[model samples]
Target: MIMDANTIKDELKKVGISINDIYDLVNTKESYPLAIPVLLDLLQKGIEDVKIKEGIIRALAVKEAIGKASPILIEEYHKIAKDKMMLRWAIGNTIYVTITENDVDSILQIVQDDENGMSRQMFVLALGKVKSEKAEDILIKLLDDEELTPHALEALGRLKSKKAKSKIEILTKHPKSLIKKEAEKALKKIG
Candidate 1:
């Protein structure tokens, strides 16, 4: 089943993947090459990982694979998150991927939904990875969403957006001490 680069390319051509795809899979900033095959195989089988380590390697590769991934591949991953255990996937995926600014924006928008708090939280933490102006409004909006406050504050702290100062300050007065603490931390960073 092993072959040279050309053989691998020919075999993959029949499946619609290519050598450049391999480059993206293995060349991410994170060491994800080790997981690429497992993740791709899992996706092809349309199965979800029940444990973190069960597919941890693959998850890491999938994460980095998104860094320069084609939009179609990104969408495919998004679909996988939606159709499966999204929270778990996000938590697992974040460790290995360095997705683009667009992926961060897409996640922020999706987390706006009330039922997607896990995604919201994951997206918040992920802002630490791909900080951008697109995340500014979304992070600020979390101030009004009681459930997202903590994660939002974390995102704001990491994102360091100038506009976040006003929104972050308001959280310092939140009834929940935990949120207030997070807000205080975010405001400190904003300054």
Candidate 2:
């Protein structure tokens, strides 16, 4: 079912959370397109374990719920993104957006997880999104990673960084056909 503001309101009310914390979220004014408004509608409320978990969960869902985000909404999105499952998904989505410098460590760890292959895709996608000069080394490191090389190469090419050129120069010579193909394509594009 499509969740409406009423459901969010009800959930917040369950834990005695007043919309005061998120008055802006509920404001119905301005052009906030974020899934959940930038308010601690659930987090700042007084509640115990159950509520805390529920609050985090509800807060987490906002990332999926939103279709667009204002700067305030994006800030709120990243703050709640500290939640694990939610953060994972958010990084996957926001990897390309202009991220705050502080968010780099955690998101980079997502790229490094090796265990979660999907995260490599997310990390690559996010790097392509950010297109930051800082991500060049990590993108190049993806070249050496036996496990994550494919996605990393793809991200590197998509990023098309001048720094990425050296790595692509090397990857184009790699033994794997798929990797070589992608590297060649990236080289052609960036050339």
Best by TM-score: 1
> Scored by CA lDDT, what does every candidate get?
0.57, 0.53
Question: Could you tell me the C-alpha RMSD of candidate 1 in Å?
Answer: 7.3
How do the residues 76-173 of candidate 1 rate in per-residue lDDT, one tens digit apiece? 44555454555434443453255567676566655676655454565566665665776677777767887778877887787776787876787788
Model 1: per-residue Cα lDDT at residue 61:
41
Among residues 3 or more apart in sequence or in different chains, the pairs in candidate 2 whose N, CA or C atoms overlap within 3 Å are 35-66, 95-126, 96-129, 96-130
List of clashing residue pairs for candidate 1: 63-97, 64-97
Estimate the TM-score for candidate 1: 0.64
Q: Tens digit of lDDT per residue, candidate 2, span 1-191?
A: 32344555565566555454333343334333333432234333323333333343334333333333223323443444333444444435543453444545555765666654543465465565455666667877777775667767666667676777887888878999888888888787677
Worst 10 residues of 2 by lDDT: 65-74
Q: On a 0 to 100 scale, what is the lDDT of residue 87 in model 2?
A: 42
